[model samples]
Structure formats: structure tokens, C-alpha cells
Target: MEQYAQDTPKWKAELFDWLKSFLIIGSATAVIYLFIMAPYVVQGRSMETTLHDGERVIVNKAIYYLDDPQPGDIVIIHPDASGENWIKRVVAVAGDTVEAKNDQLYVNGQPLQEDYLNENRLKSEAAGVVLTADFGPVTVEEGSVFVMGDNRNNSMDSRVIGPVQLDHVVGRAEFVYWPFNAIRMPK
Candidate 1:
């Protein structure tokens, strides 16, 4: 009768340990990726220069729930209050009157001074309804927001979608994570 001893090769033992560690690390990473660090890719130029289309970003879903959305902060919102996501710049907060005329934007009846826009995009576009000679001094309802794109003429923002309900907001973009060179804090 022959008996086989339990002595194992050092290389085999080391390999087994490495594989176990990798699996643990990989699984933890995936869990965090789906919940905490979900990835998003920009689809339009609505947030151009700040968040370009096709660029990838990381949304901190845990944060907006912790705090309210702030004006001028870029946010990811569900346009229809339905579960789909959309990204747009926050223009006016609740209770503010927003108007656009002669390529200028006025919030609360005061000129909205922005250092972000190099060229205004609201040229010749009617305030509420585009291509109409009429405009608006529309008041954004409480718990709602008026969002617009830096590329005004091209973006279909709050002007087109109407005021966004607060509950529709998904999260604020924390940073851009792709395209290596453009990887940095989103404006």
C-alpha cells in the first residue's frame, strides 16, 4: 500500500492564493462600480466645453440625495420624470422668473452674468416657443428648475422640456473619467 503525503509545491500554493485574492478584489470592484461608481457617457453638446458629447463621466448618485442641487452645478436629471437620464446645466432654481430675448438671458428679471459663455446661442429664438415673434417672462415653479445648454440655439433644455421637477434629478456630475487628456473636473 502506498500513501501520498500532503506536501504541496510552493509555486502551486502561491498561485492559488493569488487567484483567490484577485477574485475577491474583482468582485468588490464590480459591486462598487454598479452602485457607487457607475459610469455615464455624454450624448449631446448641451453641456459643451463643460461636458462634451461622447465624453465619459462619473456620477456621484450618493451625493445629490445628501444635498440639494445647486445653481450653476451641472446635473444629470430624468427629463420626463420618467426613469431615463439626461444631462444639462442648471440655469434657474425654483421661484425664479426666466426669460430670453435678443440673444440675452435674464433670470429673476436680472441679467444672468456668466463667465462660461463666449457666444450666446439664443439669437432670434422666441422665449418659450422658438421661431415665434413672442417671448416669455415665465416663472419657474417652486421645486422645479429651468435648465439650458451653453449652446442655446441647439439645446432642447427646460425651454423645450418645461421646468424639471426636483425629484427627476439623478445626480451631479463629479468628474470626467475618460479621454485621458480631457479627464478633469467638469465645469
Candidate 2:
């Protein structure tokens, strides 16, 4: 039956079209994930208040390619050769001097306003504890940044690992997308 043969080919053609569309979409998604954007899971309390453990964030991997990491930008970093990643706030960029004294952060000889740490600072003050201990007068070297956690007292950051090389920075964290009720763009 000539008619039956034509119908069979039409159905096969439709299936082929569907398969091709799916292939194209899959490729686009893979490209974006590899070079443009990717999801990262926050793993510790280091970024607490701003980002909590187990929270999911969408990192804009392509951003740093267009702009250098700057103070106050939340970024994802590959600190060392062990393949571990960290998320932290950039406190000082190349050539900037950073220091913490009397629980206040100073950069370039001026006190830095850290509104993001308001809650934690208040809590520490209430508890008669120092949030960030005195350290640094350390200048960030060329092509590196000084990073710190929002939960200053409990974080392992650039203070512990030294200035993070710009090449080690993975991306800027654009926003948190998981646990619907907790969704927000970290400042």
C-alpha cells in the first residue's frame, strides 16, 4: 500500500525532527553549563547568614572574564590544588591593604563598611566576643584578592590561605536558587 508507506515515512520524519531538536537543546545547555553559568552548592557555615550550608547558587562563570573581582562581590574560588572550592566575599583587591583590628575591618587605611556582617557583628557584640581577630596590614598582591567569610569567626578564608590568585577564582555567585523560601541574591 503506497499510502501506508507514505504515512510511515511521515511518522519517521516527525520522530527525526523531534530527536534533532532535543539534541540541539542538550548541546546548548551543556555549553552554557561549561562556560557561562553553573550551579554550586554552598557547603559550609563559612558564608553563614548570607549563604547557608546546602543552599544552591547559580554562579556566573563568564562574569569574571568580563570584569575583575572587586570588593564586596561574592565569588567562588578554587583556592588550591586539591580541587576544593570556596565561596567568599572579596574584601580587598590587588594592591589594597587589608587589616582587622578591634573587630573592625580596614582597607587601604580606611574602615570598610560591611553591612552584610551586621547581624553577625551584633550577635558577637551582644555575646562580648570578637567577630574577627586582629591580623593583616597585608597588601593583596597583583592579580590576587583578599577574601573573607560573612561568619568571620568560623570561616577558613584568605586569612588562612593567603591572598587567592585571580586565576583560582571560579566565578561570581549571582544568586541562590534552591530551598524556595530562602531564595535571594547575596550582596
Candidate 3:
């Protein structure tokens, strides 16, 4: 009976150790998901070619705390108070002038090299359609960013919503991690 008692205590101790480990791991994961990083599922064709609908991406929520978002950074933004998040590429930052003429995007008087839109641009031209419509020479206000989608013709971006306030930005998209075959770092 003494041997049985000792064996029971040993089994219980081992189980307790495993439970502690699991709790620690679960807590760490929760912390990362809540404050450091988060998984976001792309919802529409707005960011297509660069990010397709239903692609899973990891957003670095803590990154903006260290540095301001820059042009060309793909970011998740809450455009309105409705709590809906949209992913887009930052085309212009505070004080930069943005314009789209003849289907070309110009920021601060210089044409942006949007190599990511090569496929979409070619498709548009082949179809005799303008990829990006003509818009403002308006300067981005302070603490705001001008965003657009890689699928310029189909995206509802800053062009439709105006510049997004810095505070509305949720995070920068680091990479696509889903659909196994489509895994890659978004440009």
C-alpha cells in the first residue's frame, strides 16, 4: 500500500508540472496575440495581387510604437469608428502631396515605382482601362497617411475615405502565412 501511495503522488506531481507548463505557454500566446502581434484575415479584393482575399497575415501591432509608418509599408487601418479594419499600402505620409494622373501615382512631385502593381497595370492597359483614376494633388495632413491598394482600380482607399489618421492605423502587415502554397512576405 505504501508503494501505491508513492506512485500516486509521483503521477500527480508529473501532471501538475504539465499543467503549469501549459498555462505558461497559453499565457504567452495570449500576450503576443493581444499586444505584440495579431493574425488578420484579408477580407476583400481591395489588396489583391499583393494580398488576396482570405489570406492570413501577421500584423506587427507593436511596430508602430517604435517607428512611424512609412510610404510603401502595408498596414491595417480602422478607417472609421465602426471598428472595421482594412489593409492597404501606404503611398504618402504626412506633408506629402499625392496625385494620380494618366494612371500613374505621384507623391511629392515624383512618380512612385510601384512594381507590385505590374500585373494589375498590365491587365488594365490590355483591357484599355485606366488602373488608377485621376485624383488630388492634395497634401497629406499631419499625423495622417494616404493609402491605396495594390489593385488600384478596385480598391476603396484613402481616395474614397480621405487620409487615415495615424491613430487609426492598427499595424503593419509583416507576411502572409496561410494557404501553404501562398506563403510569402508581402512587398
Candidate 4:
């Protein structure tokens, strides 16, 4: 009877240890999913064709925490005026000269070949020229970025709001995880 009683206590202790281990693992997973690896829902069609409204994308919050934003990367940024977040593609990096003339985009005097843009969505007017037109030869200030939308006609990006400050960039959007077939890395 004494031996049986000792075994019962040992069994209970093992059960408790197993429960604790399971709880710890579950909590860690929740933290990583919510804070690090979760997918964000698209609120607008500014990135249409590339990212659609109501679709979901997985952004790597960990990547931008260490590296600088790169050209051709789609990014999420914060706006001070409206306190809203925006997602757009990085067209011109720091120190690149960006111009839109005759509806063609040029960076550093070299025309950018934007195959991702829809011809119907291209704006005829030079929207970025508002300030650059008045000021002449807009050089993207160091540590700033010029962004645009794939749906060029409809997006309110750096063209309207001016170049985004480097610090305003929140994260690089790495992939779209929702809508099943659209699950792929963003260019």
C-alpha cells in the first residue's frame, strides 16, 4: 500500500509537469502569431492586381527591424496627417531623381520599365510634378523614398503626399497568404 501511494504522487507530478510544458508552448506560439507572423488584411485597392481589397498578406515585421527598405519592395508606412497606414511600392530610393513625363516614369534619367502597371490605370497627368514642377529637378532627399501604386491612376501615394520619410516606413510586405491562389511573394 505504501509503494502504491508513492507511485500515485509521482504520477500526479509528472502530469503537472506535462501540463506546464504544454501551456508554455501554446503561449509562445500565440505571441509569435499575433505579433510577428500574422497576416494583414488589405483595406483598399491601391495595390490592385498585386494586392486586392479584402485580401490578406503576411508581412515580416522582423525583416525591417534590421534592414533598410529596398527598391521594388512593397512597404507599409504610417502617415502623420491622417494617422493611417499605407501600402505602396518603392519606386525611387534615397538620392534617386524621379520624374514622370508624358506618363512615363523615369529614375536617374533612365526610364523605368513598369510591366506591373495596367495601361488603363496609367494617369496621363504628371502627378508628382506638382512640387517638382514649381521647384525644378526634384532630387529625392537622402533617407527618403518615392513610392507609387500599381493602379497609378487611383493611388494617393508619394506623388500626392510627397516622398515618404525613411522613418515613416513600417515594414516590408513579404507575401500574400490569403485567397489561396494569390499566395505568393510580393515583388
Better of 1 and 2 by lDDT: 2
Per-residue lDDT over 22-131 for candidate 1, one digit per residue giving the tens place of the 0 to 100 score = 99999998877755666889887767756788998998776765766777887888887356778888888888888877656788888777667653324323344342
Which stretches of model 4 miss by more than 4 angstroms? Answer: 1-36, 81-83, 118-137
- Note the Cα lDDT for every prediction shown: 0.75, 0.94, 0.94, 0.75
Off by over 4 Å in 2: 1-8
TM-scores for all candidates: the values are 0.73, 0.91, 0.88, 0.73
Query: lDDT ranking from best to worst?
Result: 2, 3, 4, 1
Model 3 sits at a Cα RMSD from the real structure of 3.4
Q: lDDT per residue, candidate 2, 1-187, as tens digits? A: 8887677877797898999999999999999998999999999999989999999999999998998999999999999999898999999999999999999999999999999999999989999999999998999999999999999989999889999999999999999999899888998
Query: Per-residue lDDT of 37-99 in model 3, one digit per residue for the tens?
Result: 999999999888899999999999999999889999999999999999999999999999999
Residue 52 alpha-carbon offset, candidate 4, angstroms: 0.7
Best-fitting candidate, measured by TM-score?
Answer: 2
Tell me the lDDT of model 3 at 12: 92
Q: Estimate the lDDT of model 2.
A: 0.94
In model 3, which regions exceed 4 Å deviation? 1-22
Error of 4 at 177 (Å): 1.1
Error of 1 at 98 (Å): 1.0
Minimal lDDT window, size 10, model 2: 2-11
